[model samples]
Target: MSGLKRLLKKGLGLGDMAFSAGGGAINWFPGHMAAATRAIRNRLKLSDLVLEVRDARIPLSSANSDLQPLLSAKRRVVALNKKDLANPNIMHKWSGYFERCKQDCIAINAHSKGSVKKLLELVEFKLKEVICREPTLLVMVVGVPNVGKSALINSIHQIAQSQFPVQEKMKRAAVGPLPGVTQDISGFKIAQKPSIYVLDTPGVLVPSISDIETGLKLALAGSVKDSVVGEERIAQYLLAVLDTRGTPLHWKHLNNRRAEGVEYDVEENHIYNLKNLKPKRRNNPSNRCDLVYVEDLVMEVQWALHSTLTEFNGNVEDESDLESLIDLQFGALQKALKIPHKASEARLMVSKKFLTLFRTGKLGPFILDDVPDHTPVS
Candidate 1:
């Protein structure tokens, strides 16, 4: 493992990092997924075009290879969703790369009205070359879980309604941050001159992921649930990626009540420990001293919630009650650390916060796939 880390550090210019996972392929095929595959195959005959949505950050990993055989003969357009969160330079290169392979690819922000309108225009223009007699085109939108499929549908509907006020607006598809929210396949007709109908299918993943890193990337992107791959493990991978990319680890957010300088280092296990840290009292009238360990803060929050639930006979039904309990624990932690932070700002787990920063594009855009050594980048 040490040798591998050295090689990565020297050859790829990545930092010292090593990944450890138990021997076995990552499999995430639920029963509904098989059913979705069968349904998609059955519906392919009725569809004029297939729009495969992919995450721009991890395009190759996010793509479902199982659909290759099924979609080989179908007219397809690869819509790289979440363009806003991806590196624009890499995205432009990917567009040229896809064109060279004779595939129609478009990078689009799923939530943008202009992008959705451009996507609709591409679909209509592509359909014109293939279909001359058919007045209505049935397009099937498919992709792995949480790739913004539902959001794209809603965006299209929204733009269509605004442009053609007389046309009836369709119901918006349910959108959620988590995976597997869209359970069934449904269809909606766009109010356009030619009238295009789009089918929204549930996010389906391949039966088995041969590469563990790909699975990890999917999990980090929230396509796979944290329960499946474990949140802490994902955070470790995130840390490695950030370190390799030369991004600064902003630990100031973790510091709360200490007036003294705080220092930490990332070890092999990615555990952070404070070094040369000293506590000082603030000049406030209360004369309070602050310094708290992160591990202790997490434990206190958990214990407080557990005790509250136990005392209440596990009948805490009000959302505000839960929020209050969390705030109380966070407030205690803030006071101990002397860091001025709102109770509501306290994150339950550091791992979750780390993943959130990456998902929100706070850490910056990343392309996980290894670009070929021979491939040219303009």
Candidate 2:
């Protein structure tokens, strides 16, 4: 653990500072999760195969450690969801890491049939022998909250309906952008020939996370609620990560090659809302901006981060210095995102909108988890 911490500090800059300094105090484990864990374990005994879904951006952190022992013992496939929102170059390295651990891993975008089809094929291949002999088979899909388990099940239901028509009216699994949308385990009949059922379980996490960094990753990746972790802290962590990896520095050259050809209209005068609406947890589709609007905003944010890091003279290893840099960034981001100077909650507004852009993949693709060198495989 010490070695991993040193490597992460050297590479990504999550140093010795505790996340509690961010001023968020909330329960990590709710009562609902306590019951969900026991239910999932009981169902695992009846499941013939398990689709262990994880956030592609935080692949390792998203795994439910409490259930990993039983999950890995059964026939399982680690399905990394929301791959479209993850860094394409780093995903293969993660896949290789899983392969070394002897796990069948696939990066998938639940909304894409093309990607989901490949996963279904893999599941069939794994259960080829049982398909012929068993009269019934249960396929359970489980994950931490907001990892897109519901979306995947809905897609699978559509595919099944196409393959085998049903006379009774069927309902799709409830899908939402927030965590813990599905409260109970619901089974969908995918096939009638052999009575294959797909179980969609409520997202569950262990009572306590192993580390502060893991909790932060889960919060950033949407496995945990922003209110619990506090949006400001998550945004601070995001800035720290971008700063440590020199991500913003690389963005400078990305558009510098086109610096001579492109220009923005000064008279456009388009003001997009950077409202800090606490009521709405998800990015509203109705308020979505045009491509030109979003592109310009992203450019502003990248330049803001790049300029701040480029001008500062401080030690990245010192947690105090990093926190001071983060404070400066909140001011810079408020200006970049065009939030009103006099806004009462300017910092909170900047944090929420900034997080939305990253979560929606508007700023750029990112993978928060670094591949481990070695670990015990269950």
Candidate 3:
């Protein structure tokens, strides 16, 4: 545990010169992204308010470093989306960090109507001055890839349509799990009195990433395409972060708490059959027991990780030792996750599934980005 900060700096860097997709940068700034960036810059001139949506897991890393300067000058509210998938305990600290920087910020889940309403409340408050003079108000929503910009817009649209009378037929934004889903910037009229329009832009990344670790953080958070960074590499990075922080070991305490509750319940005559809870029909893949299997799978994966980290005698601070431990845990996870022993793409499959769990938050809530040592005064 000596110099934990130094250890993470070296170990998580993983000896990569740069994060590469195809022996090059994960530079996925498509032609549309370039055109849209220009358009967004032009439109920013007229916008009254800007909602900068960011992935809650990687608040700092998911930001477009190239556009931060421009965004900082504008009237902007930082909406950290996907809060449900992040560590709620630390969310207030992040919010406070933004507050100290004098930026208007809110952590939100785009899917929830209540959450989006809170954001809208803030947006309306920000635009109170513009609401009086401007015949029409423009609120631009911008963010990097896969950070739920479209999803947030859709929720906002639904809320606005019902609350405000609009002449145009309401059309929903194109929301997808992958990046580059929004090819063109489209506007939705959310209110009629002042004619507030919310513009949804294509998710864009910088021409070049600021650093490889930032790139990996983006990839792990699904801002960058998985193919660009490779699933195995991202999963390894995830494992490394988990190990170095001793995150899985904490799961032991959580499980122990649950075990105590279960034992107490058993004593209180609440009969429970642990063995029978396993999915009965494995052949029928779509069986309802699949949910049970998923729960079991998560438990197994957690146990495997906890066991490996606890038993393995090695310095997790050392890159080689950490790599060795990650490899061992990969094998342990493959078995725990029940990947086919002889499958040609077993490792890849394991990586994909493992990443899925982490992304979907079955693994657990996480906040990948750490708070900066000094909060810049804006």
Candidate 4:
């Protein structure tokens, strides 16, 4: 462990100031992350209110635990983004959930002004305590990477008509806390009447891997591949729910396929119809369809898995194809297989690489469509 520490130190060449500033002797802090933490702390001093942005779907997961303590003295406003993508009823429930914590909660679509208006209102309300002392409002915006934090800032400023012009205009661009910047701090000025200043911080995350898990669960519940755990688990869980809901195929289509002999028009009946027509047990749609939207889901998952595998760049690329197995039509199959309730593991199984690969843009945004998984196995 000490060797790892020394190697890290030598590798990063942390300036003597970092070691002396009582930042605490961190034995294993990744260089980029350590700088980001320092940047966050420094930025906290220049701001009065903290605007924490989180994915509306997974608000808790997206909260920046690393910056939590730093925000102890400041007013905190939690902004939930991508409300349009979340389950609406759940979104309301979550808003109430955060209100109980003394946190100002607002749901917004980062891409639209309507979604953020409520957020601006909440920020002004939270800043009431310090608004009197400084005519210029200093609210710091923070969130984890790729959670649309940057987009949120851009959208807010655009709508406000330069009321919250970026810190660059205030000559405090050097004061903001993001690690990549060489300047000290960034500040903003409000352009219009409901005056407020805004500072944007790069997304931050907790030190532990479990933090990422929590964050992933909230943001990826609907969009993930399947319910394995965390993002994937929730994704799988949604798939199971969609299964019960009889999704993908409208009821009309289901009936039409059953009435007619069109294989694609029907739902799960393709398996049975194909079997009935064969001299041997074969797949050919004759006239009846048995399954519902769940079959199409299976095909989608199968296609996603295949595309993920074929695109893998690691040793997995040279590995033999995964043998066709039973369909994982329910989210429970992930648990039954004893796979970790983790999106990372499922990602590796599907894409054959570490989870970071997916984050770093090495693998996906996998494409999936209504395609059958089996074709006579020939």
Best candidate per TM-score, number?
Answer: 2
TM-score to true structure, per model = 0.68, 0.88, 0.87, 0.51
269 in model 1: Cα distance from truth in Å? 31
- The C-alpha lDDT values of all candidates are 0.66, 0.80, 0.82, 0.46
Best by lDDT: 3
Look at candidate 1 and tell me the lDDT of residue 102.
Answer: 76
Better of 3 and 4 by TM-score: 3
Winner on TM-score (1 vs 3): 3
Instruction: Assess candidate 1 and give its TM-score to the true structure.
Output: 0.68
Q: What range of 10 consecutive residues in model 4 has the weakest lDDT sum?
A: 317-326
* lDDT value, candidate 3, whole model: 0.82
Expressed as tens digits, the lDDT of each residue in 1-378 for candidate 2 is 332243334433333333333322224666777788889999899999999999999999999988988998999999999999999999999999999989999999999998999999999888888999998999999999999999999888888888887634468778877788888888878888688889999999877664667877888888788887678778877887787777888888755624667765543767565432122344653333344566777788888888888888875556666667778888899998889999998988899998988888876899999999886555
Sort by TM-score, top down from the best: 2, 3, 1, 4
3 against 4, candidate with superior lDDT: 3
Candidate 1 Cα outliers beyond 4 Å, as residue runs: 1-23, 164-168, 249-348, 372-378
Looking at candidate 2, the ten consecutive residues that score lowest on lDDT are 17-26
Task: Summarize candidate 4's per-residue lDDT along 135-208 as a digit string, tens digits.
Answer: 66677877665566666776676666554444343222221212233212344555444356777664444554
RMSD of 1: 14.8
Give the distance in Å from residue 377's predicted Cα in candidate 1 to where it truly belongs: 20
